[model samples]
Target: MFLIFDNFIFDLDGTIINSSKEVFQCFAMAFESVNYDIDKTRLNPDIIGPPLKEIIKLIAPELNDENKINLICQNFRQIYDNDENDCSELYDGILEFLKKLKKHNKKVFMATFKPMIPTIRLVNKFKLNDLFDDIYGIDKFGKHITKEEMIEDIISKYNLNREKTVMIGDAPTDVIAAKNTGIFGIGTLWGYGSDKTELKKNSNLCINNIKELDSNCEFERILK
Candidate 1:
């Protein structure tokens, strides 16, 4: 079962940067800026990976209309964009892992659903841009870049062999994206999209920590 992927595409949110604390803080700041006086502690958990507009609609269900959702979403961007000093930080051990992947000669890139603008900001804000060779993120859904498509784009962007590219994420969506392109999918247990049961279906395998990924290539080759 041993197989090796020469290229790897990764998800940003729960998979790499555990910015729950800062995200929560930013969500609260956004609403407060809009005169809503929202509490981040309560709203933070829901803001993990989805777009701010989606989170705004979920949190401010009372304002179900489109216009209000847009406004609140704008508020969110204001807060998230205002400061990078607090909103983005790589999860501990991430740098070590990325360096290892680089040393192994694996092409590494980020293929996240996170909008391109903020994704760029977050990477540079935290000085993570150097670790990745390419960054493929979409600004909006209807722009024709399906989340899954980003995986394909990254694989092709680097001219990677389909059998040698892996997509590592925390959601079932990640699995669909990877399989859509005949690539490998690896899930993380420390994220929001999975419990033990869901893990079995969505990924070729699941891992608990990035540090555990020291032996990841061996496991991925076998599992896939």
Candidate 2:
């Protein structure tokens, strides 16, 4: 019997984890290390799921040079890396959700703007590395890697059919990425990017609860 959705591509950070605590702490550390104190609430510091370059540009518009961006990123990573796991925690029901997906024989993956190294670390640290066949993340240069690369990689990695894949995320980026790759995109309202201003506006489906993500969604433009 065929399943409703075969492959599940998940965006980390806000989608599966309530990582704001660790995120704010790391950013505060990063700024403090550079002697630049930051007020987390004032600066809107919970931007872990958005594209890094976009967040950087908004936060430090004065430092437009590549080198300065690199430095800030390095500092952030330096502080973020020391005890990266300190503030990171999986969202409620997330582990069970993964187990359910795996029980259904569906392929799961990570597709996020976070750099590959830390992303890998957190996954492994939380014992989630074994849950996915292909885990995708941003490179060290802070480039905005599209979800297409991730989808193509997963397809090539597992020989998957594009029609069988779906991207689950909170931000518009994830929705756009899925569409660009010719796959269906679903957004979660329980994330930082709730209500899909630009992301879910074009999404095929969306759910407020992660548990509501399976099998019951109304198909929009899917082709057989």
In candidate 1, stretches whose alpha carbon ends up further than 4 angstroms from where it belongs are 1-3, 37-42, 140-144, 193-196, 218-224
TM-score: which candidate is best? 1
**What is candidate 2's lDDT per residue for 50-153, written digit by digit as tens?**
66556666566665568767777788777766674476778777798888777667788888878787787788788997788777887633565576787777
Go through the candidates in order and give each one's C-alpha lDDT: 0.71, 0.72
Model 2 residue 5 CA deviation (Å) reads 1.1
Candidate 1 accuracy as lDDT: 0.71
TM-score of 1: 0.85
**Candidate 2: misplaced stretches above 4 Å?**
1-3, 43-46, 64-67, 140-144, 215-224
Give lDDT: candidate 2, residue 30: 63
* lDDT, residue 18, candidate 2: 71
| Candidate 2's TM-score | 0.84
Report the C-alpha displacement of residue 148, candidate 2, in angstroms.
1.8
Report residue 196 deviation for candidate 1 (angstroms): 5.4
